[model samples]
Every structure is written in C-alpha cells, then in structure tokens.
Target: MTSKFYEDTKVIVKDKLFEHGWGILKDLYLGETPLASIAQKSFETATGTKLATVYLLDLFKENIVAIHGEYQSQATNVLSTCNVFIKENSTANEVSNCVDDFLKNANHYIDESFSRRLFLKYGY
Candidate 1:
C-alpha cells in the first residue's frame, strides 16, 4: 500500500478504535479488506475498494473480535470458516499470519501500532 493510503488506513483504524474520535465503521475490516490488507496487515487504496469491509458503529469505543481473517468469499464457506475460526481461534497470534500477509502487501505507512494485536482483541 502507498504511504497515503497507509496513513489513511491508520487514521481510519485509530478513529474507529478510539473514544470520541471521528470514525464510523460498522464492523471491523469486514469484506475483502483488500486481500493485501489481510495478507500483509494493511491496505492500499487511493480511495476505497468495494471489497473493503470497514465501517463504524458509534462514537464511543466498543468491544468486538477483530473479524479480519482469511476464508473463502462465498457465504457458505465464509459462514463455516467463521464458525471454525471462532471456535478454534485462541490468542492474538491466531491471526498474526494473516496480519503478516497484510503488511507484506506493502502499505507504505502503517501505524506502528496497527499490527500489535490480533484484530480488535485488545481491551478497551
């Protein structure tokens, strides 16, 4: 990802995670999140991608499992995979591989803290 996009993604992620910040993503990186985002732990979009699954819920911070995982895109496969991942998923490392892939995609400016935790598993 380019530095501009990386910076944008960082701002978006932080705003979504912070209290009284200015972000409004419904769920964590929901959709494809750019295969690259999951692959390397970041995203690159001059604007936005249809596959990107980021949205805001509210202004106040909320607790949610970081849903950024790799799985088949189809609904059936996705549902089944989600069941398996949620049931089998353990600590933050469960998604580190995915995150590593996300960074490898080459987002030029990832916030130093973006990949610190697995998804949104950190305490609020």
Candidate 2:
C-alpha cells in the first residue's frame, strides 16, 4: 500500500474499531487471514472482475507478504485478534480502554510509519 493510503487506513481502522464492537478487516496481503479470500471473492462476485483485479494486482502486491510476515509476528496477531465481549451494561469508556490496549500492543508489529500514524490518531 502507498504511504498515504496506509495512513488513511490506519485512521479509519482506529476510529471504526473504537466505535464498533467488530470492525476488523483483512488486508489483501495476509495469507493466514481467513477473511481475505472470502472478501476478495465477495467483491468479485458483486462487482465482476474490475475490483478484484485492482485489489489483487495494482492495489496490494502479493510479493510483500514475506516482508510483511517479518513485521507481523505471531504475538502481534494474538494481541490484535482478541475477541472482546462487550456487555450491555458496559460503559463506552470501558470499551474504549479495551480497544486502546489492543492498539497499543499492536504498535510493536506494524511499520514505524503506521505506528506513528496510530499514535497520532489515538493520542496514546
């Protein structure tokens, strides 16, 4: 991904994940992400070949996975992929803290640019 889009994705992911109980998305580069293929196929089925071609070829490069894997280690995946159960009685602040903790832990695995973007966006 380009630096600009990466920054934008970071902002959107942080904000939406903070507000919603479930807003995690699978990037096109990750092989282990279960949603990646499904999301790709879904887009293809809905929009024909146009979107998937751009997504798979132009937008995200498959060759980046080897380098991406080095940064996105197993511990990072575990910390970021936690399944939090938000109770009906839970306050918004409580939920925010949980998400913030997840994001803070996730900082270790991402690139410095993306990490800086998240820190600026979330102010922590």
Whose lDDT is greatest here? 2
Error of 2 at 61 (Å): 39
Cα lDDT, all candidates: 0.28, 0.32
Model 1 misplaced regions, further than 4 Å:
1-24, 28-87, 106-124
For each candidate, C-alpha RMSD in Å? 16.3, 16.7
Candidate whose TM-score is highest: 2
Write one digit per residue (lDDT tens) for candidate 2, span 1-124: 3333333333433454435333334554545332222111111111122111001111233211100111222224323333233333335465456445544543333323344344445654
lDDT of 1 by residue, 1-124 (tens): 1233233343434443233222233333436342223211123222221132222122112222233432222232221222111112233343334333332331222211233222233422
Using Cα atoms with residue i matched to residue i, what is each candidate's TM-score against the true structure? Answer: 0.20, 0.27
